[model samples]
Target: MPDTAASSTHLTLLDDLLKRALAHGADAADAVMIRSDSVGASWRMGKAEDLERSESTDVGLRVIRGKKQAVVATTDLNPAGFDELAERAIAMAKVSPDDDYCGLADPALYATDLQDLDLDDHPDQGAERLIARAREAEEAALAVKGVKQSEGGSASVGRTTMALAIRGEGARFEASYSASSHSVSCSVIAEDGNGAMERDYDFSSARHFEDLDSPADVGRRAAENTVRRVGARKMGSGKMPIVYDPRVSGGLVGHLSQAVNGASVARGTSFLKEKMGQKIFADGIRIVDDPLRQRGLRSRAVDGEGVAVRRLNLIDDGVLQSWILDTSTARQLGLETTGHAGRGTGGPPSPGPTNLYMEAGRLSVDDLIADIQEGFYVVELIGMGVNYVTGDYSRGAAGFWIENGRIAHPVSEMTVAGNLKDMFRQITPASDLTFRYGVNAPTLRIDGMTVAGA
Candidate 1:
């Protein structure tokens, strides 16, 4: 049962896969094995709505023949299927189009410093605990005076074991022992005098159950946000200082992440493609990616290619310093890999950021907004109207209006538009940064954005 639940046997299978690929007319190959177990529950209106549990074990093989490459994935763990899997991958590679930049990372560049990131929290949080947590979240949300109904409250626990194996200059193997996650969320609806309704939600997640915010706190926050949005009115259109709450402000940095992604830059599809080594943000702005943060949601010791991953200052003092790169994209640009390769079970590695965040400035959220006389403080954004290719930005937004340097009234049905190229340059971050998501930023105040409304 221990072996079934989790095992190091995948390491042996990786070697077997690589050997079979070489025997089947392949020059090189890599394998990835993933095993996952998860359980979840949802509670609504004081009753359990559903209980769910699942387990899946899957493996993928990628083969290279000269300049051609192919990938195949399967769930059949029967050792009998691996040989056929390798043969089929090689056959596909034989007819595949040649990609000049496709190849394994240089053997000399493999990560040697294995760091324990404390990613997994053991003693499995059982199904009963998950359901109980869900019930607590729902009851707490419903307890709020103005909250009319609970959209739903949910709790989940999941664990994953991952291994990567490759045959390149020589054989190499690395495996993520395990990663576990716990999450709880609640949503509530509130009604205004005229029966108009508004809904809001909040959630907390962590690698360890103990790190999650109290279920009551999550529920109360959801209720408070929903009630506050009731009967929101529209604001006038104008170009003004736009403030971003930490929740949605991270999106601004998210756009920056996409702009600096190596794949997009290599394909000539990014707005900042030619802006390398140039000042992209305000002089005080700094952006970083850290892959070794203990308990971080996106933390990892090594990238998909087993390249040594480390923290990088992607944007240092406003200058674009690095492109998130994997071996493939780095080669295409005639540069060295930056160890930013991210992969999945069915696709080639892609360059992406992990635990990306912006450094905070020496200003509180209130202090950051104190200077704004007439501005929009965004709490919610709807729709995807961003165009990274041209740096154009437009989005549906709702939040509060800052009047005389204070958040005054709830506002909705407004549209905010600007060019990201300008947004980044004018953004000033507050000193309230928190690492709560894959991409995080503090409350930010951006100057000169067009807010359109009544």
Candidate 2:
């Protein structure tokens, strides 16, 4: 984790920058500082391939004059340079095109009573541990029978600190937070006697080092996944049921997110633009976005814009409940901000989800697949063939074929096609939801999809 002394210094620096921007004839301003340190190691075939360590600090300032705003970024932390940075921002804002919705958030809505989400952890041991982790993972993967070659193993640990300060009419705010992350991953190829080779990989990440999966466990899982695809064959073309494993099921939820993004909806480019208060999914389905989840991968007490954050039901009872929004997009749609704003050093704030997930269903994985006699169980997806405007979905897929309600053989080089509108309506959720990614869903089964293969 980052030291408190450094965090305090960053907050002070942001405050000084915001004050300078205001003094230079800007109506309102906000400044953010980000500092990061990371260590990584990669090992392949029992030898260390690379070792890396990095540290940096970056700052961005947004200044608004009247209805126009300008943003500037810099890596130089010298206080003497702040005057020129502020002056440049104000001058740019003066000549910038007018935008009615380009200012700070409402002062009344500023976040207060921030909570500790426990996102940071103790410091890492060093590069030595990371190298050992990578070596161990590669060795474990090579130990598995049928495994032909190692694709290398990797481990990384990182910490980031963010500080923000806002100076607007009747409102002044400052906040700082730090978070840590650790990850281990392994990839390997398996070959059958016929000279056919398949590759698979697995990895686990968490906010704390102690929560990550063991290197051996990751290696074994990756090897097992690779071994299963040793004898993959292409199936025939036909329309059938499709069951998505947990690894790929989250993509469906991501599509939903894009369809409901406030920016896309405002631009009239989303298929779900007119889906408010409509049944977009099967009955009894619920989807949630919670930013306050303890130790969540993307958890935060407040959004990137210093707005209060909370849990929201983006979907409830299979109905479209809310749109992912920020202050600017919300204003364009004549709605209040949903506190979903996110930002980086080079651009303005935008709306996005944090800790988004779908609720699990009552049916088990086996029960979900029991009813499908001839279907495709998708484990991997390829291509970006989704049309958000029309909801037309088509993607290259690979996985196993289902015969007699059981996994039969691996299939590859297949394309699955269906309209998302129909797919969402025909979807069924299984009781295997896990919180492994920022966006999560259970094992999903969608009926009435077409599969094309040899």
Candidate 3:
């Protein structure tokens, strides 16, 4: 850890331990330090129901001797504690069994220049403010006409600091961010004596509270979504085009991408083995992983291994471009790291996407559905039924009916089944691109999917 005067001084302590490890018969070493603070408040039935606040700091060190490596981590930040931890890590490394694949990243691959990212920095607003926000969101939900009882509402805030250092190639960075989120949900009893409806809305803001969604707006949307679900019925089972809203589309794409990772390929478990440069999807489909998006939820200047991060094309114009790779997996497969390493003190690094997103399409959501005689606009899915090695896919789905380009009624308790390989090639995307989460996608349409229902 480079020297810093802030709370992240534990980073320096970690750096010092790494140096000690190198001097104590280790070939390579690295260190990481992290500090975080969080607060939360909840309101229900017009009263405060729960509140919590906490802060914590931790440091970890790793040592590698030839083919053997060991790691030790501790939340205690005192100098004496750090020294003991370092000694223990070296001792563990000495006794560890040697494997051919364990080592620190090459010095040539380390990032030198650090990027100045703008993360959250706001004065701590006490529990009272959090409670107030929770109450406001809940009250707005309860005020809706058909809302009989609010299930609950909550507000939360979190701040974090992180630092990293490597032995021979010293690199250091410090970043802090603040995030707040509020959510409200309610159950509505219909006036016609038909049944009950339920829904919820959530709003999140980073940097400050002013960026959050209005309580009234959240409440109204929740009420609308809930009301639409009333009297949902099952549809006849058949193969048809399926449209996935942005929220659900992201999850669908994520599942597909995970199966294409290089680690899985190296292990002979990826369905995409030997499919590089092959046409794997519709002509318009593209999947990209970007780590430098400004203020992006998962954006980072460097990967977990201190490698420079950049945008990578996983799939371009339906062609399988590349698979996500970490250092170990890349080495095993004779490829370069894709700057997708995800690891911490306790485990080896794994490949993961940074701000993964699918490129938007030309047609608006309505236009994409206009020609469909019948379809389903999926809003949510439950339970997982995906086989990475075989590319088989199935899941429980619930959403609204699409008829002649219009949303008709909600449908529930159905199953969607198809081969992921076929589904990718048959899919189409809508023009609506909303950036609300780490994984994002436009509304997507997959044709000829099997929907199991009555």
Top-TM-score candidate index: 2
The stretch of ten residues in a row with the least summed lDDT in candidate 2 is 1-10
lDDT of 1 by residue, 1-454 (tens): 0132444688787788888889898888888888888899999998898899999988888898899999999999888888999889988999999999998999888887768888887737587887788888888888888899888999999988888888854756555567888899999899888888888999999998889998888888888888888888997899999999999999988899998888999999999999999998989789999998999999988899888899999999999999989999999999999999987779778899999999999989889888888999999999999998999999999999999999898899999999999999999999999988989999999999999999
Candidates arranged by lDDT, highest first: 2, 1, 3
Each candidate: what lDDT? 0.88, 0.92, 0.74
Q: Please give the ranking of all candidate structures by TM-score, highest first, separated by commas.
A: 2, 1, 3
Per-candidate TM equals: 0.97, 0.98, 0.92
Candidate whose lDDT is highest: 2
Please write out the lDDT profile of model 3 over residues 15-126, one tens digit for every residue: 6777677777767777777677788888888899999987887676777777888888888777766567777888998898986776766656777775654445444648
For residues 1-454, what per-residue lDDT tens digits would candidate 2 score against the true structure?
Answer: 2347876899888888988999999989988888889999999988999999999999999998889999999999999999999999999999999999888889788898788999999667499999999999988899999999999999999988888888977668888889888999999999988898999999999998778999999999999999998899998999999999999999999999999999999999999999999999999999999999988999988887889999999999999999999999999999988999997878788999999998999999999999788999999999999999999999999999999889999999999999999999988999999999999999999999999999
Q: How many angstroms is residue 11 displaced in model 1 relative to the true structure, after the best TM-score fit?
A: 0.8
Output the better candidate (1/2) by lDDT. Answer: 2
Give the local distance difference test score of model 2: 0.92
| Residue 151 miss distance in model 2 (angstroms) | 0.7
